[model samples]
Target: MTDTTSTETAVRTGLFIGGEPRQTDETLTIVDPAKPGVIVGEAASASKQDVADAIAAADAAFPAWSALSATERATLMAEAIAGIADERDTDAAVLSQENGKIRFEGFIDALVFEIRWNLALMLADEVDTGKTLPVVPGIPVTTEVSYQPLGVVTVIVPFNWPIAILAAALPHALLAGNTAIVKPPPSAPLATTRIVQRVAEKLPPGVLNVVTGRDENMAELIQSPDVAKVCFTGSVNGGKRIMEMAAKTLTRVTLELGGNDAAVFLEDAVIDDVHLDRLFAAIYDSTGQICMNAKRVYVHRSRMDELVAGLEARLNRVVLGYGLDEGTTMGPLHQPAQKAFVEDIIQEAKDAGADVREYGTLPGGDLAGGNFLRPALVVDPDPSLRVVTQEQFGPVIPILPFDTEEEAVAAANDTWSGLCGSVWTADVEAAQRVGSQLVCGYVWVNDHGATRLDLRAPFGGMKQSGIGREQGIEGIRAFQDTRSIATIDPEALAAMAH
Candidate 1:
């Protein structure tokens, strides 16, 4: 990892609007989450006027951008993507410092953003592909059905995976011929702003923009009458707030919110070394900050001991430290508040007589002050415990044991969140049966978590988790509106009149 402290000047970021980098009188100081007192960078704190400017810029650019052919837009975006990798190392290191994720995960975040961008680009031709309907006896007219771009769009991303989550909608919106303004998470905006500004610079002025500021300054991004749609990926409450604000303009919204995903292991589940490794990573990767990571694990009562032993072995060997530290396997929780929240949840579980086993040791010296928490497993906790029932967006997870497949599925579906769920079993048929029964938007059979997610498939939550889907053809359509053109057919009209 690059030594961020080696340079005398800290990384400074500014808003990207109208293809220019603009500075703000007030700026947000971004610190290394792993070492909160150490300032890593600063981002322009967009004012209310700045937010309106971004929306106006996107609105101004929308007509020309939307007029372009899908192929033209795709070609320009491809050119921009080709240049994005030039600063990968620096960007990833900054992300690591600011987001409290291991360096490799930080690198993967940017890589995944590019991957999703390319994936969305691949669907360019399909954006303008319209279907023709033949004349019907009763209708007496032939019609053409087409998808048209919504105008200016606002895309708000969360702190956990800002760049990648922004890509889930940004590229698709732009490729579908809409102009976009991105609002990166306020706490971890430095690296995301740098990356988005780079991409925005290569595009047409106002075709893409980035604004970093407090939530209070961003009301216009959603409620502006010029804005056609808002794509937000964040907490459930945040999504609800976005919906309420957007409702003023009756703007369309695509929300990818929080999830308390469940992973079920059937009686015939494979608990081999490889499977255990995958399971461990699924539960604890990025220090368990991912929205889709398995928050609760439901194991067959027969294999509960085996699974617990395997996870314990892995947990005992974890190394917690700064994200850039080579020896570290897991970094701290992104913020001190989250650390406190997770600690409280674990204490609550322990008070309820659940066996809360925590592993790993915090590093000494300056690192001691970081938001570090040992990875923990709550063994066979009561289903009503906060760790089991709530979205524990931290490194602690609850493991519950069930006797029957019906019970496992019931327990998994009991949560208000239905984002994603997985079934683990050697029996493919059983995997299908149980996976199909889980009431989530996406289900994985035999494998689980973001590592196993299919980018080409649509991803989102059901119920309180989220309102709409992202990725695949469905994602592109989320940024668009359907239109129909019809003309009277003389012969068919005469026949129908007769």
Candidate 2:
């Protein structure tokens, strides 16, 4: 329910509650991250009452929406996908304003990664019914397995990769017969809200809803009696809070939280354009805000200097500015708070005697006031340093050289965040061997991120990275519960008992 009549102005937005655009007197102003002083727009500041209404709407719609055939559900998503293409340029611009980077890449990834994952989940209906195993013989007794949607689903999207994260929760929930309420991160809600508005308009009223508000609204949604499942993507601490709150209602939860993923380059690894380019992209993409980003680089002593030189040389070409700028390859951190957090980590690493080689130069004008920073590459930081041990979630990474296989494996696995990682080597066997030792959900051999994501593979973090999974059969199943049915013949049962 966006105002299509005016495209030039700061398009004031409202909460998409109960399938309609509902507004409140209190609204939060969103400013362009690239243009700090310029206002992007104002979005509804959803109060607790708004959240309760959204949950009620979703609860009311679940019975009918989830009862629809898989084909019908799939059609709704297909329509949304087509709408995405039509508004790609506009959404990209809006996305650029709300967040400093990833509008283009995020949009493309939604099409490539999101839609692909959506299609896989669409097949979940058939898979759930058609793929069940035959019951063992029990003299005329038959047993069947089936999947049922988990009613109302609450999706909390992170600001970093909003569209892609939405795809993970919303579409699957709808296609599997569940209704959903989405809470877009306020920091970068404009573009994400635009995308949600498109989907909400296409789908039946109450099937999908989006809200913008403070943290309390989310807690309310998670603890709502009607919400059956909650899918969240953000910080580990945030996930923990959600879990603790949801426990009261015993609502199901899936968390895709933070990561301190390491990229290990073997002694014989190729340091040429192919590997180095992908490696750099893995760490720098989204300004290193991605959950699966390579936060630590472990290289063999033999090739440490070469890798550093290559990374620094590539860093020279990076331009930090507005997302839409053709020459701008990097962008500012969306949140001002993140700037201080990242700075503290880097400064702490430096204090620990780490050799920090920083790159890129901040420019003036609109970019000067923006949250810009030269991406840092710290060398030989103490293993216990914050930069080395915790998830940076910013454009700063640490590189350390390892002497042996045991040292490299120990160093890579020495973290609570086990989201993902990579192993670089000429020998596939060698890479495979080492990748097996890394305690992560997925370990790439030569590259990283969405480029390496197998469409049907399950995506989730291991250990403290959080529980459950997203994507693949498991992903669709998360939105569903199973039922076992059996038909027993009385005569057969009596005969068997005799």
Candidate 3:
């Protein structure tokens, strides 16, 4: 990992509306999550009028944008993406400072956005591909089935993985011929706003826009009559709120919400070095903030000790420090409230007599006041404990032991969350059998987590986890509406009349 400490600098960002930068008198000061007192940058605080202007701009651009062929739009998007990598170094440093992930993760966040953009572009030709239903031997009607753009769309991304998460829907919406207005989370808006503005600058005016501000000023983004669809990636409660707001206009919505993802290890699972490393990264990568990060681990009783030992061996080497520091293996929570929340959960488990072992040394000096917490593994806590049941969204995780494959699958599916789950085992048939039973949107066999996620596959949740899928062909179609054109064949019509 490259050291970005020396390059750290404050960023000032403005809203992108009608493809131009618009300044606001009021600004929201964004603080460094690693050092709360440190000001990372200021973002333009969009007002209700600004939000309206953004929606209006997107609505105005929808006609021409939607009229163009998917191939034409893709060519323009490719040109825009070509220059995105040029400023990645600076953007990565900015993201690390504000969001508190290590610089390498920040770099990867931007890179993933570009990767997803190209992937979405690959489906341009198929976006408009329609099927013709020929008149049957005795039928009189011929029909053409096609997909059409759904005007303006609003895309809201969460703070955890702003740029990468935005890519899950933004590019697809544009390629589907819907103009979009992106709303980056207020707490960590600088880097996202900067990157989105850069891309928006290269595209036609009003084709893409960005708004950053307090939640109080964002209702119009979702409820406005002009917004045909709203795609949001955030908490379950937030998704519900978005649904309520969009209900006013009966606008369409696609929500990718929170999760309490589980990882199950069968009795025959391999507990070797490679598998152990994969498990560790799957659980702790991004400090366990990822929605798909394994929150609870269920290991068959036979492998419990080995799995715990392997995790501890890796946890013992964790280094908590500033995200820009090259030596830091993990950074602080994105906010103080989250740090306190995780700490309270760990304390509650310890108070209940669970064997909770926390590892890592907090960096002193400048980082003394940072929202830092050592990574912890709670060994076989009561299944109902918050550490096991809730989405920790931090560096602490619960590992429980099960007696059989049936018990493991049951334990994994017990939660209300159905975002994702994984089954690990050497027996291919067992992996299949257990993985098929896990009640989640996507299942991983032998491998797990975001690092192992297959981007080409449809990803989402079930029950309260989410409303619709993002990515793949399914994701592209989320921004479109279907149309059926029917014509009566003269000969068939005459035959029917006779």
RMSD of each: 1.5, 2.4, 2.0
Could you tell me the lDDT of residue 283 within candidate 3?
89
The digit string of per-residue lDDT tens for model 2 on 343-438 reads: 899888878778988888897886777888889899877788899888898998889999998899999998998999899989989898999999
- In model 1, what is the error at residue 467, expressed in angstroms? 0.9
TM-scores of the models, in the order given: 0.98, 0.94, 0.98
Please say which candidate is ahead in lDDT: 1 or 2: 1
lDDT of 2 at 261: 95
Instruction: Go through the candidates in order and give each one's C-alpha lDDT.
Output: 0.90, 0.81, 0.91
Off by over 4 Å in 2: 1-8, 109-114, 121-127, 130-141
Q: Give the clashing pairs for model 1.
A: none
Clashing pairs in 2: 66-177
Ranking by TM-score: 1, 3, 2
* CA RMSD (A), model 3: 2.0
Runs off by more than 4 Å, candidate 1: 1-9
lDDT of 1 by residue, 169-245 (tens): 89999999999999998889988888898888899999999999988899999998999999999899989999999
